[model samples]
Target: MQGEEQWFSRTPGVEARQKIELDMVNSLLTSVAFASDPSRQLALEIIAEQFEQPATIRTHPTPRAQLIEIVRTYARNPDGLRVLVDVVASFDPQSFGTVRLRQLFDEWQAAPSFTDDDWSAFRSALGDVVLPQLTELFHLATRNRRHRPPAHCKTAWHYFVHLTDLNAGADSVPPYMIFLERVAPLLPSSTGQELRMRNHRLASELGLITAVNEIHLHERESLPPQHHTAYLVIQLESDGIDPERYTLSHWYQWDADGWHPERGEDRTVSILEIENEVERLVFDMETNWVEAVETVTLEFILPWELINAPVDWWRKESHSSRPTPLTMDYPVVVRSLERLRTHRWHRAWHVRWQRLNTDPTSVLPYWSKPAGKNYHTLLETDLKSDLRYACLVLSEPPLPDSSGRTEIETALRAGLPVIIWHRRDCGSPDFREAVQQMLAGETLAQLPILARKLRGEALRLDLADRESHIGRHLTMLWDDPERQPEVSRSYGTPEEGIR
Candidate 1:
């Protein structure tokens, strides 16, 4: 009656709340042992209620140990696990100190070493009752770990290696490898490869060989650039069954400091791994050459399809909102149409030449069949023959639907400046901020203007500092006549410009 009165009261002190909670926990344990279904549910409800109370209502050791045991034991039981998970999830490590919980977790993690039997028991308990909840608990633990940054000199790699070594039987490979792979490309080449090799060696040493394959670099590139004459074309590849079906990601360069990926530095060429029924993995590397003699086209072969075909098909339906048969309105198709429209005049006149030189029917698509006159005849006559400079234009948001952003980014990376006409309604505030930064030289605006400015300044400055500074080295090479052959060799075979 006293406990019932306190439970119904508007406010109860720490002592009363703790006594009630302890009694409820003991009752729940009794009910679980006796297999009393109704009492089990009632006990869960009582635990939930106690958890909802302020932290001040529960003291450190008692509540912490009780919750840890609940998580460690009943984590496999659907209802019981849910109750424990809810309590832990509700805790704010910042507001309510997580010190005790963390300590208990460390103990639980180390419990196996106390005795071989303890390890076996934990494994059995996890396999039977807690396996389903493992992912969620793992995420919770990871989040908590991230909240308080590890001490200086302690990298994530350190923690990962330590844990995997300590808990050799735990299936830590999938999640750990996934995180590493995601961040790998962003790391410096040397550092990235070192970490990867370390992971591979550790996995092998621990006999976790299944995870070793995941550490291998599936994508390979040709080589790095030499000088002003040539640029490196990195070919990336994956072991995926159908390579051509996957869209190639933009090639990124390490910035001036050799740390971060350069912003706005990309190539106009689109690389894809195409999988045809006949050809298992065909790399369709596409790029246009307007002026440069050579270009580096990176071919990436992934072990997995970067774009899942079914997901892509669903995405097409959702984005275009066209019926299945009418889904030809997708971005890729739309882009081809836009390019056709822009090149109508060139195409029509070229048809006359192509008829004599090769093919004429290809030009017919631009003309409206019903109308006698060609739709793009006027555009053809206005075309200039000796136009030396091409403008890379950025007029709208680089939405996936518009490949313009990719095109513009590629041009800038190739050291071309772009002309951007600001369209206020087409982009968000963040995009506008990016544009402002590009103009001010604070950030690499991925605009051609920045490239032009940097190149122009480099040409005017004295380059006596070549050996010491990388910028000077690039500048010296830009001026060097001897390096022409080397630079030229790095540039891949030039192709026609993308319209």
Candidate 2:
């Protein structure tokens, strides 16, 4: 095995360079932006045709799927991988006029290897960035307690090893590059890559070959990306007999690991008092999860009737005289409590969710128009068609009297993952345009972030006039079938005979 000195050597073998290229290709190709780009398919097809041997690739429905197929086909072949690296490095998006790929590839190549002096400088820079936040980092690192570092992990490097050095065992310190990338997002300082690049130039002035060359496979074995934003799921189940009263159940989701049920009293409240109860729930969220997780998104699981409730506008009773809506602090989205209980539509829900992520442009919203009493049947037919509409935009408030309720239910039954509507003015041209503007992009997952922006705009309006704007009344049933909360089997009304 090579010593630490030889590991940081300036002259790397051809194998090392090939490994670096492979890493670059994987990172660039798997990126959401690159995978979804319109130009990718043609570029990939042309590249395949350039091969000496006929590369018979299978056809996939979406660009993302196709890109994944391309990666699987070419990643192992050195010549094919080199071609991909070059093509992706030259990608230029026509619509956005952004040229990021070339710049990123250039930086990757330009970054220098670490000399002993460069490593020292890099470590010192890390200390400057990470030392002040060391206590905070320690707390975050040891949040689970069982995974806490041993007493001997007193230095910064040891603590870093505990945090990011996953496959290398408990006490093995990570390379300088790995350490920088792990701690780059730490508060108040120069970035990890930036520090490395700067040290390269300084070292070159002293006649050292300081540029990074060999790809460190250990970088791939680092910890999964930290989820800074946690989710607070507030599920409101209606009392079967009473329309106004509900039994509230709440869960806190830390990450993709799924929701953990919080032990609490079975608190029932009237519709009028629900907002105040939600305010208390928000407080509990702050006290319990928000400090550790920087941001908390509020996901309200509501029945059909309360789906349009202006829960986002509900103000928290804060110390300030003029407290803002929950939307100002958190990205608030609603989920169908009815849909959660029904397993019949879940397969469609899951399928549509996958389609939405893979091919968002194809999953356009089905805009409803005011029609006869049998309008919902027509809407269901439209949703279930080969068009595979995953989103529903209502033409009226989904009240019992209006067609919105039927429209929403039809979409839910057909497994549409998204439902957007202005609570009061679904017929307005402004709302139509707003929906258009929001769904113009290929990212259906960013709906929550966009909805938050709209809510913030609504909050800026006078309280009396706020209701006039679609932003104030905008509600989206942005349900993700994958990230659902754990509910009791007997909690809600199960299917007809399952009990």
Candidate 3:
């Protein structure tokens, strides 16, 4: 296995190649499914074409000898060898295990040879936030790995700078890039929002060295991966539960250009048919608008009485197949119909929204004390005082007349934009843990996606337990003040829906 060293030592230009690079190339060549000598020659030919210089492969009696001849040729031009090394670094992980290939590629590409300008741009973006406890953030992000930061690094920035000069053995990406990805979720939304664009530019400039060779370097941040999105806004109004008004008040679509409104229709339905009516509106959107948009998010604007409705679980029927939950396909979030009707709480909403945007970590779900004697009074005071408490996670179902209902209304009045709760008895620790798992290092906007994932997981369990799982019961009221339906009709009569 170590025989390559002897050949490499005698060969000029090969001295610069790392042992891991040689090993990787050898492994990639040997692992490829080659039936015969002609196939091997063809593979070598294909690899050779990637280089600028034209070369001919020598005819060898044995395939092993042929591999050595190919490398010998590559050794003559170190730049060509770099190209070969890159190909080897990014060989198909299907033939090799992903973990092993990733590790091998990282170890092989550990030369963090970026220029001063690149470091300057990265450092500037990171300057706003205090060097986020580098060792701790690293340990939290890379807990599975056995590696530790060198003892000499005084700060996270120092460690990242140090990484650029030294080749740490397990380095797929620059330590700074990884640091950015990890910290992106933790940083206040205002911080590092521009880093993605900067990073994309840098990644483009890096070209093949960073993008092609390092496949997993750019993890999908919340920015830049913009999709053509459509918002289906459903406003529901009920009068004594007899006849409910359902209106497709707004169909807002956003693309690279910006947002444009589409006309919607209104309908009247009995209390029993409200869910069915909502489903039909969604079906119409899927049929009429889904083909036009890249992604769709369903927004159900409901009064306080119906706020706890599981809109995500509602399904639309198709003649061809069984119905699937709306959440299974699109992100569904509940919005406050009452909140949209008035500008009274607009100032509070703006204050909290700004706080949420400025420091998301500070505005994480604030749990209300559900059982104290003066819990409601205390909770109201806390919410009113702290504009930073943008999200509220209740301990019980917010059904009409319940304490949970009052808590929710208070939170809404206090201008909290997000409220999550189990739709039923939520005192169980499992619900809290489930919320924790969904929110761990995730942006607030990602809750619907994460909650859908939990629901999907629940579907895999036994039917009896599935209903009991936190996934089925979790309901979130995520009202973004920035993105709202332009209510044409005032919250006047039940007969006249909010158009």
> Which residues of candidate 1, in runs, are more than 4 Å off?
1-69, 72-74, 77-90, 95-97, 106-162, 165-392, 395-421, 425-499
Candidate maximizing lDDT = 2
TM for candidate 3 is 0.51
List of clashing residue pairs for candidate 3: none
Ranking by lDDT: 2, 3, 1
For candidate 1, report its TM-score. Answer: 0.23
Summarize candidate 1's per-residue lDDT along 359-443 as a digit string, tens digits: 3222111111112244223222222221221222343434454433443333222222122323222234443444454444432
Q: Where does the lowest 10-residue lDDT sum fall in candidate 1?
A: 474-483
Candidate 2: tens digits of C-alpha lDDT, residues 403-483: 788778888888899999888888788888888888886666777788888888877888787777778889988898987
Number of clashes recorded per candidate: 30, 6, 0
C-alpha RMSD values across all candidates:
22.7, 21.4, 20.7
Model 1, clash count?
A: 30
Candidate 3, overall lDDT? 0.62
**TM-scores of the candidates in the order shown:** 0.23, 0.54, 0.51
Best by TM-score: 2
Candidate 3 structure quality by residue, lDDT tens digits, 47-71:
7777667677676776565666666
Query: What ordering of candidates by TM-score runs from best to worst?
Result: 2, 3, 1
